[model samples]
Target chain A: MDGMVLVITSGKGGVGKTTTVANIGAALAALGRRVVLVDADIGLRNLDVVMGLENRIVYDIVNVMENKDLPVRKALIKDKRVESLFLLPAAQTRDKDAIKPEQMKELCEELRQEFDYVLIDCPAGIEQGFRNAVAGADLALIVTTPEVSAVRDADRIIGLVEAEGLRGPRLILNRLRPDMVKRREMMDIEDVLDILHIDLLGVVPDDEAIIISTNKGEPIAFDNNSKAGQAYRNIARRLEGEEVPFQSFDNPSFFQRLRQLVGMDK
Target chain B: MALLDFLSRVLNRDEGSKETAKQRLQLVLVQDRASVNPHLLEELKEDLIGVISRYLEIDLSAMEINLESGGGDTVALVANIPVRQVRRSQQK
Candidate 1:
């Protein structure tokens, strides 16, 4: 597990994989560890925008692979907020075929020598983009919502990740509502776990602050004040193999008490 | 009984309220990932009945086959393929 290469992927789109990469990278960097966030999305890259470094992108992953003259340090985009944080952007103009899996593995190896953590922001869909993104990764982080579709896609991705000779594709149940799970109107957290059966990393309660931060191109994890932000930070700590207890959603309605009484049903 | 107890606590904590739209969306997603349409499962049941009854003397009406969503990667098939010997009385 030394010099970890982690890929954040979900077969389904819009499950917040890029957002996780941005926030986790920021949090890890803030902890004084050298971190590189690699956007493997290629043409559909958004990690640059999420990290508010879209304008600074001159050379991308493709450029570094093709342009032998460009140095790795030059392609690394250091986060304005954190000194240890950096990003290797995807080529927005070219397609996912821009880089091969072997090249990605080489890049990750080069990055592993310099950075403590290399987090790949994987693109959705199980095609070439996914193959390239997961090529050099030591671990996989499956991002899903409490919903069934995301979980299903996550499950599919989990199989693929395992098939590729990887390990520990932990679950991050995002956009969960504690209030909804209590009412038996939505699938409980337990139900989702039963279906996917992966080790739980952390749960992110859906908050409006995530949208606000996304719009501002400032990651919520940098805020350190929002609940969702805390969730992401906690996940980062967990990724570093630290044991952090989860915070409850703080719903004390009669039914929530009952759900707890019954054994945390969802 | 444990599941029932757990659900009761969930209901009691949330004041017996129903699920929100987002939750329903998630549930639908899970079903979709399994490629399981309830209608499709029913059709499969009917077709399985026809195929199994064509030659065998088994109780087709008692047959049961289920498709479960195995997380996100697989479509697990759980089938109860019961068979019985063909008695000579029906051979004509």
Candidate 2:
């Protein structure tokens, strides 16, 4: 089957790159698509723990890379909760230098033949790990928060990603506090889009449910009640070529609504 | 008293942290994204001085060249060169 290889990356750490990979992979699998989450973080691998598949990793992507005879299927650990979802754990004992970009490209070519979507969780920083992650990908999804440092790094990453021939990378603004945005204490969606100048895939509100889900080794996308989960689901649908309207995070006041109705609000 | 407080809060909303963050980010990114090589700029400056010296004498010490963000995706190459004097003869 022809598959899309998407690298979920952020130049800055703690921006939810792995979380996006897990949720988007799980969401895609729930939609009956065969999905595999590849943790490209190498020594600092945590996607397995986040996906609750830490105990199931007998072999990892490194094993497949070293042993050319080893089938890629043997290294893949199937997700317990979601059908058609799999995880290719990164090697915790090794570092980013263990794998080459060419090997990653070959591995992705092999994976795309079997899975519908191959979502790679890129490590933070513009080092070798970042290059290896994007080396095999057809598209990129940049993750960033509504912060100064994160946006600046993202701008640098955008230039680097383009230099590597990956064009039109989409942005995923994560951990946005709607209440803060409403109070003008946090940057709004428009403010971020203006600086980044990339097409936004989706916006995930800062929800406590995400923390709880991480603690439970579960993705929020499985929960129907969580707004963040709904956002992930919407992003999944959008990835499937579906046009979905973004969810409004602001709880507009009566006067604000009236202003909007009268086209008086910017 | 409560009504007055609410009005004050609404009126001061524009001076919130959001605007500060956006402005700061924009300024920082302008420098970060302006990865134009200093060596290239120097070479360009030399070429510019050589060409302009034929028609007008410009001070080399006072020249300032930089790449500034014109908001969004555009970047402006700003050059400030002090003209010392104009040559009287037209150079072929």
Model number with the top DockQ: 2
Give the per-residue lDDT of model 2 (tens digit) for A191-210.
99999999999999999999
i-RMS for every candidate? 5.1, 0.7
Tens digits of per-residue lDDT for model 1, A12-73: 99988999889888888878889999999999889999889999987889999998899888
Q: Candidate 1 falls in which docking quality class?
A: incorrect
Clashes of 1: 26
* Candidate that would win on lDDT: 2
- In model 2, the runs with Cα more than 4 Å from the true position are A252-266, B1-14, B36-64, B67-92
Question: How displaced is residue A121 in candidate 2, in Å?
Answer: 0.3
Candidate 1 wrongly placed segments (more than 4 Å): A251-266, B1-92
Q: After superposition, how far is residue A197 of candidate 2 from its true place, in Å?
A: 0.5
Per-prediction DockQ comes to: 0.19, 0.75
